[model samples]
Target: MAASSKRTICIVSPGTARDNNGNWHTADRWARFLRDDYDVVVQERWSARWPAPDLLVALHARRSARSLGEFREYHDDRPAILVLTGTDVYHDIHRDSDAECAVLLADALVVLQPAAIGELPDIVRPNTHVIYQSADALPTLPGVPGRKDVTMVGHLREVKDPATFMRAAALVTAPGVFLQQIGAALDADLERLAERTNDTVEHYAWQGGAPREYARDAIRRSHALAVCSTMEGGANVIVEAITSGVPVLASDISGNRGMLGDDYAGFFPVGDAAALARLIDRSVQDDAFIATLRAQCAARAPLFAPEAERAALLRLVDNLFHSIPSIGKRT
Candidate 1:
């Protein structure tokens, strides 16, 4: 391990605290985790105006590409850990030159889920490691006595497919089935659609952004989580739901499959609102099916424990800073 007396670590997140998105959440958690052993701080990006730390953990490859590239240019002796977000792995790196440069320049790469490993180009695969995100367990809270509430939480983004959630809400025919969506209207067009959804769909409610604690409580109170995202590097919400003893009904995508496991029984076809609606109905009426989902979630929850995430992150930093030779050094 590196000497602990005065180590400094910097986290660069594309999303800032005001955004309260997944990237910010991870950066904030890591800052807390490393604060005791290292001088840790979180910022949207690093520039020549600010002091560089001994190490950099950047949250988005494409979005933070300038920060990553400039760090190598300016410092040339330290290490930068480039964390690949969903778009970075599946979309950005393939088409975006900045993302390509970020990967090439990284001393180490972090992918949030195991399955994302296959998406990396062969040249960078050896340097990459999977680090699952985590959420602390919430105290159990009961849902309305018999109501079946399913929730999908994410900002209104194209990749998240909130429209799917809205359509699924309309299609659900099960008695006492309620669908709630919690997210900011990041996209104005999408926000309008959600408004229409709420007005037309009696059981669907689109509650805009809430406090972090309120969101946690909402997840705990819901009977199940519907993660209809089309892409995810790894969603923190999955960890939150699983650790809170909630089962998930997710879209059938590698990201969700990667986090929830291949054998997880609760997947509906991606973007197929009818299929999602059917799954939601089944969750309410079939006790045995719901039990199976609960069992599968319980099995996966250990992988997302706070202790596990903290250890993995620290170990990654220890090896990158202490054991491995630094890359991008000008000398």
Candidate 2:
């Protein structure tokens, strides 16, 4: 590539990468969006052997802490964008020094959902931008009327609270209702809970981990998606559900509220199985309530569309290159 050509941008996300999975999917998605205008490379980490790029976009403050630090040391004057994840905003930024340092070192910051802006310190707030995660709208499946199936999509971790959905299923006394939880178990306790819940008579099933296509297909087929996370920076699952036109029954957290609006009617208190159960029962029994949620979700769906995200990303890159003196010299 010549100096006058499009700038080469490197995205450094130290956490695991997947061809098609949770957070990795978000990283890959952004790379695909940027490919048309910039030379983009996605990597697990940055090291001494790697060639320096015109700009750096690192994901997850905590997991990419070392990479962020190293890039700052080598390319302090380069345009570097730090993207925050749920764990980084909700937990690490407050407690981890390395994570906090990553925020200060970046030229600009990106948060997937809107509410995350409030979590930043006063100084960092000015450079922060909210980029709502986007998804490709899947082909809509034929509406299977009268089937009372609710779906939850997330890996079984301490933050995800898979048990909340299981316990909620036990409390639901609705006749035809069924609860399906999908995700890999990362925690031993959650794995045991899944086993115990399966042995019981409640209308719950742990389908374990499925391929991304199968999981999204399941979301498209379901009546609603259950989001029971204790904390989230911005969940891509929320985007998937909204883009699929599936209504959501989410936990009442800022992250969830950020994706769904603050005025959204379908939130239950986090970790409260009874509250979740009541919402599930209401969604099945009350036609007006379900329709209301679907309407709200439909109204918000465009925010996560692929075109919107691509526009924001391109605009950010354009603006950064124009404003930053050293980066502007590259092209």
Candidate 3:
């Protein structure tokens, strides 16, 4: 394909793609979105031997640090977009040298949540863009409808705080309520927690890893989504819940707040099982309050719709290609 006729873009996500959990899936979603307009290749890793593309979009600064460095060394003049994941934005950028290098090496930075940009150093602030993740609601399930089911969707990991949701479910005094967690247990400790929670709480069930369709169906069928995360780079669960018309009870972190809005009332302090329990109780017992949260989530749902995300991404790509003198030229 001729250089001008075919726009080649490469996405580097060095994390294990087999897991297909969070950031890996995010990279896949963005790749699918870009595929229509550009020739896009998604790879777990990129090396010096890889062909140079017109643009590179990489996810997870620390995980793809080597790939980012290689891309920079090999394609210095090409525009590279580095997407900051929860770990990359919250943990690695502060402590990991490779993560910091990825930030400096990129022509532009992408953060899923608005608050994530605050975590970036002032040097890269100008180039950073906040692009919220998107999801589509699946067809409604055929099961019983009236019983309120609170769902939590995330791979069981330390950062995700799966225990918080389980503990909250156990502590919830409300009857006729269920707390379902659907994700693969990525950590041994979390697996133990899930097992224990299942044995102890009659209402809590850990339905180990389901396909994305099943997960989305769970979200659609649920009364609400509980996001008890220690940190996030704008979780896709929040977007998924919003788009599915399910209210959210999220941790009071900037990442959650960035997606749920700073003024959104459905927030509990991070890692506070008691607070989460209280929120769960209130969501079930207080109809007015729950409706208010639902309304707030509904108001913000359009921001995460597929159309909005696609437009913002295309605009970003167009601006990058047009502004960069070398890449815009048809060879």
Winner by lDDT: 1
Local distance difference test, each candidate: 0.89, 0.86, 0.87
Please provide TM-scores, in order, for all candidate models, with all chains considered together: 0.95, 0.95, 0.95
- Tell me which of candidates 1 and 2 scores higher on lDDT: 1
Q: Taking the tens digit of each residue's C-alpha lDDT, what string does model 2 give over 1-331?
A: 5566777888886654543455578778889999988899989887646888888899989878888788889877778899999888888999999899999989899998889888888899999998998989875565456667799988888899888999998899877888899998889999999989988946788998888888888888888899999999878888888898899999999999999999999999999999999999999889999999999999999999999999998888888887774663553
Model 1, runs deviating above 4 Å = 1-4, 324-331
How many clashing pairs per prediction, in order?
A: 0, 1, 0
lDDT of 3 by residue, 1-331 (tens): 5566557888887654687677777778888898888888888888889678888888899988888898889878888899999899999999999998989999899999889988999999999998888987543454345677899998898899998998888788887789999999989988998999999889899999998878888888887899999998888888888887889999999899899898999999988999998888898899999999999998998889988888888889878888785773565
Where is model 3 more than 4 Å wrong at Cα? 1-3, 137-146, 328-331
> Candidate 3, after superposition: displacement of residue 311 in Å?
1.0
lDDT string for model 1 (81-131, tens) is 999999998899999999988999988999999999999889999999888
RMSD of each: 3.0, 2.0, 1.9
Q: With candidate 1 superimposed using the best TM-score fit, by how many Å does residue 96's alpha carbon deviate from the native?
A: 0.2
Backbone clashes (count) for model 2: 1
Per-residue lDDT of 8 in model 2? 82
Candidate 3 local distance difference test against the native: 0.87
